[model samples]
Target: MSSARTTPGASHHEDAVGTAADGSGLLTYASLVDGKNVPSDQWVYVVDSDALLQDAFSSLTLKRKLESGRLSPEELPGGSIVGRVARADRETVLQAVEAASRATVEWNAFPLDERLDRFGALLHRRLTEQADRTIEILLREGHPLALARWQVSGALECFSPESLAFYRSQMLHESRHGERRISVRRRPDGVVCLNPPQNAPLSSALLGVTSLMAGNSLVVRAPRSAPLGVMYVLHEIVAPVLEELGAPGGTLNVVCGDPAPMLSAWLDSPLVDDIMYFGSSEAGIRFQERCVAAGKKPILELAGNDTVVVWKDADLEYAAEALTESFYGSGQLCMIPNQVLVHPDVVDRLTALLAEKAADVRGGSVRQEDVLLTPVLRNEKFFACLEDALSSGAELVCGGHAIQDDGTRDTAGIFLEPTVVLVRGLEGARKVQAVRHETFFPLLPVIAAEPAPDAVLLDRFVDFVNSNPYGLRNSVWAGDPEVVEHFVTRITQGGLLKVNDSHIGFLPGLPTHGGTGLTGGVYGEANYPVLRTSHIQGVSISDGGIRPREAVFGAWQAMRGEDGTAAAGA
Candidate 1:
């Protein structure tokens, strides 16, 4: 499954296209519109970041693009020219929406059970079979093998039997009310438009398929920076499943191009009911307002400044390992831990363990199975946050330098070393930018509060966690059940809470994404794509043909027992 290759240090190319490991031509993808691979005059060339870092390409056009600030190697994943894709225009975007609107008529009418068996079951099976290819594409796009595996696994878990069953129950259920049938059901929200994030686009796009289980037709905008993996998922994996189920053409449409124009088109389209958007909180909140103004539902997957609390009695080794997860993909992902709140008593020991662990998290080529670091082209923000933390009385515990692919320090290095800083007092924690916001780099802030009684300390921690404006996932590491219970019941923020568990790991029955506050915008909550992309309605039916007046005044009628005469009991 690995597409590992060796290339010369310098090579010339007319365009961004390279041979595969077996010497076959690189894959080319087209925008999927109305169930067809639609081509365009324009193209977005995808370069493998790893290849760029290795100096595999020295084309004059590439150099000029870089010199002119048009291309950033940090944005790409692997070293060679991975693939190229067509760029969509306004007409293509409109066509996609129309196709989705037309398909929903047939799609939304299918029985939930049938939809699950055909789409859900079949998707899981196909992804499992093609898991290797999926991971390979992800790796080529810059995700480390381990992170890629986790993404693939998380996507598969969403379609697991247990997950499907839970969704089934939520979509519709019935109950008997003596002579009547009372029911509650979820209806598709018509055509849905999804804009997956540049980071981890493929897996995010795959997970978006859950909306279809709720009977909604979809139009996905593959991120222009990383579209191949997403294009493959939709055009290859999902399209085939929809076809096998005899789904209508346009049941699923995909396009790749600029976001602003496509988003404007979606906002203007009457056919688009819900837009599943992923981005920073500032941008997402603004977009949410726009979506509402346009009379469309905004399903946001925004920024996360997740916190990990380590109680004094926690397994320090295990907790340290979990905290290290923040460095995965250089902490570019939203769900990874952003800050650590450790008990004053255990703060020193935990920081020591973290420092030791951080030393082993090396930055290198993305093709290496063990490497997690990717290029950080815009590291100025990372350094700014670090400076803010240092100025706010925080001490750098380990790593505050840029590391090269060869594990050496250089100011011009493309990777930010896994850095940790310790802030002494919780009261002043947020004064540090790294503590207050999502740095999106491999910098972790460990804060310890002034010593206090267990109950008082627990209360303060809960208050601090709730005060966060962003709410994605919050986690606690504690051995005491009572302490865990206190944190769980008192903490009033975040979408998911983990106690003595992996902070960013996924489970079949749990939501892989979502949050409250800024993380999800005005209506944000733990997102289940199936539920988020649908609406609910209550229903009641009676074959007894009860009179409308009698039904409306049933309680009074029962008391009178008919003919204006009370029953024997009455």
Candidate 2:
């Protein structure tokens, strides 16, 4: 394992968990087949300070030398070189998949209670002990420190004892019938491949924790752009616990590299039973089809074009505060509020309030890094999106320009100023590209709804939101309980419904992802990790002589207190 050199700056230390790197500063930690971290001569590149300060997305191959072994690195555009990352090869990835496939049998047979207890303890320990390290990597990746901590800590909190207990309860079935018993069991999906989003690696990586708890072996493909946090959590936090618990070889395996080939390998491999994917709708939909063709289950957390409805009665102060998070992480998050649907009565006031809040957003600052918007690499695409919004009869409210350290207003600069735009009405807003699609920037497009003929303006608003093609999450801000309920019930599109609260934050045990239309694939399935990674089968054991039809009739009669003739008549 080799690279050019470790540039002077912050450094990452391999934890004692299970990470082992060659002396050349290249780190490798995913080929664990049966509780062992198999050493790899192939190196995954880690970007250094020189590469980051350069701001030039150099071909990662520049950092690779002939001595680095057989693996050749490729350069990708539109990402910061936090460091060049070295990753596992195709052979290693397959071995990891096969390992998980083999481990699934014993893992599924493991007692549910014991599995939950042991894994739950590991989650708590890792969160308590290594949280700071996780947060540090997130910050270095340019996430606001507070938000980074939220992502890191939230990942751990998702596996809390209460949540796991709730999931465990769902894993069992109990029924009784006149001297007979029936039980239904939840079985693991065998090998689950977790492909987390690149932007929020830590939280996305932790999404698979419940799958592991469900007794399904895991093969995680860490995002190439930011693999450290995922690797740290896996090797440092998860891998150690598996080893200590005597988990079977091949129970957990991880790999990091380019996604195209890795995805292909996973899709083609018959051993893989399920894929937990967080990615673009196009890729996810294609992958879903292939998974279906192969008889594999695909649990997708796809792109979100989230919409938020603001009723005339909404507390503007509270609504403004919650809605400003649309600009959080430069609006790069999948769950970030993408479009605002405000009643015509409150349009001007809400727009003004939102503009005021957006102006306070800090960008391109050293001391205020925690609040500053991370610089976007795809400046051209961002500008094109901005222009498209403006062309569709949208009026700029507060910010609509880029900010740079050199005062050049270069779009290439790391930060695009938090922007607010107002369109005259829903029709105009719908034509705007920013409103129609997911803008991965701090661009908020507010659309004022025209008054409905009936008194149910809120109902009309709810219908409009429900009509949204993308459905990761949709929120409504209204103080009236009836209005909130009406809106919530009518809107059947999004994976989650938020009322009078921030839309992006997730509750434990509940799904953080899932949706309809473009967001959740054809079936509109919810990507609940514990539920998605397992299947249920009914089990029945009976005393020797009872025939199948008689047993069924007896059970039905016992419950309803009717004889066979009465049951038949009913």
Candidate 3:
């Protein structure tokens, strides 16, 4: 038996376009639109399903046929599609949005404990039975097994009941202002449309849990290229829990389609009150503007160009180990140490250790646990940046070439040599292309900066890191307490700052997404999703909470629906 099923509007050519019972072939994953699985072949007419279908087809000849509208019965491809995915039509999208809007009202009305309990059950399932299933789907999607497990585990911890409670308290709380009693209430912003990036499959759901907890109905559009893992987690793991708890059909709607059209729907529809977008800086800015124009809120998680600083008194070995994470996931991660600023005194030894570590990175299939570096799509961009760095007074200390095979893997995946480039000095690094932009590759640029007096060096490093356009996270390795304190107090660039600790991986209680400049948006602030998607309204309940002169207080009370003729202070 095959895993894929024919839904409405489907035209199946053969059994090859699905996962086999033995788990030998591709899984033509389906979209969950309004709590129902809609297959890719069954996409409605409003969607350009044929175009999407062609993208997944294994044969180039078949792709051309489908593209030119010349695909005949005899010309239909026989082989399985490698990246089969479902694309939702306009009708389905609108239906999901409408259902979400309806569900939002009921969800908000549910008792707080009941809502929390439902989520509690979800967490329990995710950590137990769904744990292995989630990891398998993640592995099938090309994520390393260890990374897949870590992502699932971390996300589970983040959405735990205790974590949610802590986040809620931070977002909203009640207090007394002088003699007046005030209660702060956070209201849902209605339907939130989540558009997560393809790089990290779990980000959408990880963030979406916050909105759901805050009583907002969600319409999450899974990335078309990597929808299987997301769909598996949602449909297989979370959906069952939702059903068991008798959640409304629209309470958590998910769909997959061409991102351009889905983004258009989010911007055009008034039903979507908020759009949580994760992508490049340019596109995120444009989307932010569109959302603002449409009277909707946009929570933007843009690009990151995190940097690390190594002081003279630091442990060079530990620093090298931490810096090696920059090549993890082929440097596709947002928070990995992309650039490092080392003191000239320890620059030589540190660079040597770092180069040796980078060379040891194993390159293999992305699904493999030992393979820390995976194939990157933007080879031209990576090479161009590498060339620019070499030409601009930067010496290639370790790797400077692309390797088809690392003598370990037989897979046909593009592999870039784990590269480490040494810059002449901090001034020279400023001119290097790799230093100018966030190079999302397995390339790290090391700059040697001459340290000044203790106070002066601390200020210089802080300013230097702050000047970088991208700022998701930054870290420093130093033994001096005063130096660490100075770095922490003076640095106002990245959202997260680590002192002599591993820079990768996020904890459950800390702010997960935040930064300044490019890493964050125009109004860059620490992202607390539940708080960002909500507004705080102050309410005062008393017999006479407002007491003022007749000219102003009387009018205010009358406007507030209180009797104007009531006695003073009453």
Task: Name the candidate that leads on lDDT.
Answer: 1
Clash pairs (backbone) in predicted model 3: none
Give per-residue lDDT, candidate 2, residue 387: 88
Q: What TM-score does prediction 1 earn? A: 0.92
Model 3 ranges with Cα > 4 A deviation: 2-28, 39-83, 116-121, 175-181, 405-413, 543-570
The whole-model C-alpha lDDT of candidate 1 against the native structure comes to: 0.84
Q: What lDDT would each prediction earn against the true structure? A: 0.84, 0.73, 0.71
lDDT of 3: 0.71
- lDDT (tens digit, per residue) of candidate 2 on 253-275: 77787788987898899898888
Candidate 1 residue lDDT tens string, 237-317: 788788878788788999998999999999999999999999999999999999999999999999999999999999999
Query: How many residue pairs clash per model?
Result: 9, 16, 0
Question: Who is ahead in TM-score, 2 or 3?
Answer: 2
Question: Which 10 residues in a row give candidate 3 its minimum summed lDDT?
Answer: 44-53
Model 2: CA > 4 A from native: 1-30, 48-86, 364-369, 405-412, 543-549, 555-570
Order the candidates by lDDT, highest first — what do you get? 1, 2, 3
Off by over 4 Å in 1: 1-24, 56-79, 559-570
